[model samples]
Structure formats: C-alpha cells, structure tokens
Target chain A: GQQVMQIPQYQHVQEGEDFTTYCNSSTTLSNIQWYKQRPGGHPVFLIQLVKSGEVKKQKRLTFQFGEAKKNSSLHITATQTTDVGTYFCASVTSGTYKYIFGTGTRLKVLA
Target chain B: SAVISQKPSRDICQRGTSLTIQCQVDSQVTMMFWYRQQPGQSLTLIATANQGSEATYESGFVIDKFPISRPNLTFSTLTVSNMSPEDSSIYLCSVYGSTPVGNEQFFGPGTRLTVL
Candidate 1:
C-alpha cells in the first residue's frame, strides 16, 4: 500500500507571511496533484505536477516536485487571509485511477 | 472539468441506522471515489467505484459497512450501514478526468453526516 504524509499538520501565519507545506510519499509517484478545501467546502483542484524536478507557479504560489518524485512542496508568498484552507496532495496508484491523499496541512492566516 | 452534485448535503442520524448518499456527475467518468473526512482531519479514501463492476474498498474499510452502487457512468451511491457515532464525518464524492490544465479531480459539495 502507498502512503502519503504531509508535514506541519497545522499552521497559523500572520497576514503577509509566507507558508509552506511538504508532502512525502513512501513510494515514487507518476504524478502528483494539489487541492485546496476551504472551511465547509469541498476540495478544489489547484495544480498538478508530473515530471520529476518540475516547478510550476501560479500567481504568488509555487509548486515543486522532487527529483525522485517521492515528495512535493507548495509555497505561498505574501499570504493573505483568503489563502486560509487545508492543502492536500494526492497521487494516483500505479496502474489505477485510485488516488491516495496526503494527511493535509491546515493553514490559518490571521488578519 | 465536471460538475458534481451530492444529495442530502447534511444529515443527522441515530446510531444503528443507515444513510445512503447519492453522487451525480454532469459528465460520464470511468472512476468515482468516495472519501471520509473526520473533524479537523484529512481526507481518507473509503472506496473506488467503477461502472459495471464491484466497488473496491480501501484498507480498514469493509464492503459490509460501506456498500457502494455504481449503476451507471455518471451516477453512484454509497450507503453507510449501521451507523455509529464514530461514523460522523464528511463524506465526499469525486471524479477524475482531464482538464485544460491537465488531469485533475473534481469533488462534490460533500455530505455532512452526524451520527447520534
């Protein structure tokens, strides 16, 4: 079985501060996807990283995949209150559509 | 991208009872996944349902407790049988597909279940 674990189970940051969450997997992954779930809402697709050692950016957020493809990280700079949510990293099982979600990191940004 | 809707957005049931949650997707998808999110916790996959085949339950989850029915490509149902207080959690349904950006997953609003 594959297991995905995320660091910083919970984080609270002051507005304008930066935040980062790490996702580590027990085995290498073909692709990894990131999701954000707001309070009382469902998880929404954020981005996906496929190639090893890949880096992608969206506005103030940046995503990076490890060269081994066994880990990933999401960093948000100048975070705002609106950036508060639980971040989850997911990867599909080999030869299957089933996705295993990481433990998730809950972010709380203060005003 | 797909539009996913779940029925009974929230419910409160007594112990020993059963609740059936329905998921409807606007487009046909090959695989549908059910997940459980406990309070202040992360998402845990309960099972994966595929059309024309039996659903596959994840580790620690049993078919007898969480029965799933995938009658068609765009519809599925998950029934939590003999519910208990420990079963109180948010049940989410998601579908996987390709989008303009790349392959991704779309989740439903989720059913908030509270077992008394």
Candidate 2:
C-alpha cells in the first residue's frame, strides 16, 4: 500500500512567523498537489507540481516537488491569522486516479 | 475543478442504522471519489465511483459496508450500511478533471456523521 506522511502534525506560530510542512511518500508519484482546509470547511486545491524539482509560488506561499517526485513541501511566509487551518499534500500515481493524502499538518497562528 | 455539493451536511444516527449520502456536481465528470476523515485524523480514501460501473473499493473497504452508485457522470451516492459508533466520521466527495492550471481535484463540503 502507498502512504504519504507529513511532518509536524501540528504547528503553532505567531503572526508574521514562517511555517513549513514536509510531505514524503513511500513510493514514487507522478504528481503532487497541495490543499488547504479551513475549519469546518472542505479542502481547497492550492497548487499542483508535475515536473521533478519543480517550485511554484502563490503570493506568500511556496510549494516544492522533490527531484525524485516522491515528496513535496509547502512553506508559508509571514503567516497571518487567516492562514490558520490544516494543510494537506495529495499524491497521484501514474496508474491510478485516486489520490493518496498525506497526514495533514494543522496550523494555528496566534495574533 | 468542479463545483460539488453533498446532501445532509451533518447527521446523527443510532447504532445499527444506515445512511446514504448523495453527491452532485455542477458539470459532468469521469470519476468521483469518497473519503473518510475520522476525528483528529487525515483523509482516507474509501472508494472510486465511475459512471455506469461498479465502484472500486480500497483495501479495508467493501461494497457490502459502503455501497456506491454511479448513476451518471455528475452524480453518485455512498451508503453506509449497518452503522456503528465507529462509523462516526466526516464523509467527503471529490471529483478530478481538467482545470485552468492542470488536472486537479475538488472536494465538496463534507457530511459530518455522528453515530451513537
């Protein structure tokens, strides 16, 4: 069975602090996606990385895919209260449409 | 990404009962997936629902317990049969398809189930 694990199961940071969550997979993946889930809300797609060692950024957030395509990371710069939520990384293999979700990292930013 | 919706945002049920959750997408899609997130846990895929055929259940999941129906390209249902307290969790419906960025997945507001 394939598994995706995320580091820092929970993170608490002060406003303007930086936070990062790492994701690793047991097997190679074809692509990886990052999602943000607000409290009592659904998961919202953030970004997807397909090429090896690819990096994508959105405003204050940055995403990276490993060269091996088996891991990824999301880094939030100068966090704000609005950034408080859970961040998840989902990976897809070449043969399946199903996503393997990583152990989410719940973020809490204090003012 | 597609706009997806799920019926019965939240429900409370007693043991030994069954509940069916419905999912509808605004546009047609080729595949729909069901996932379960237990309290303080991450998302676990239950099955993949494809149009006009039986669902492909993940390991540790079975059609007998979580029967799925893919009547069309835009709708599906997941029924949790003979429920118990352990069945309490949030069920989510997700769809994957083309988007402006690339092929991506979008999730519906989950159905929160509480079994007692």
What is every candidate's alpha-carbon RMSD to the true fold? 1.0, 1.0
Model 1 compared with the native: what TM-score?
0.97
Q: TM-scores for chain A, candidates in order?
A: 0.98, 0.97
Per-residue lDDT of candidate 2, residues B1-116 (tens digit): 58999998999999999999999999998889999999888899999999988999999999999999999999999999999999999999999878877777889999999999
Query: In candidate 2, how many Å is residue A85 off?
Result: 0.6
Model 1 DockQ (Cα-based): 0.86
lDDT of 1 at A103: 92
Q: Comparing to the true complex, what docking class would candidate 1 get?
A: high
DockQ in order: 0.86, 0.88
Give a tens-digit lDDT track for model 2, residues A1-111. 888999999999999999999999978888899989999988898999999999999999999999998889999999999999999999874587778889999999999
Candidate 2 residue B21 C-alpha distance from true site, Å? 0.4
Task: At residue A13, give the lDDT of candidate 2.
Answer: 98
For model 2 the local lDDT of residue B81 reads 95
Judged by lDDT against the true structure, how good is candidate 1?
Answer: 0.95
- Cα lDDT tens digits, model 1, A1-111, are 888999999999999999999999979999999999999999999999999999999999999999999999999999999999999999988888788889999999999
| Candidate 1 residue A45 C-alpha distance from true site, Å | 0.7
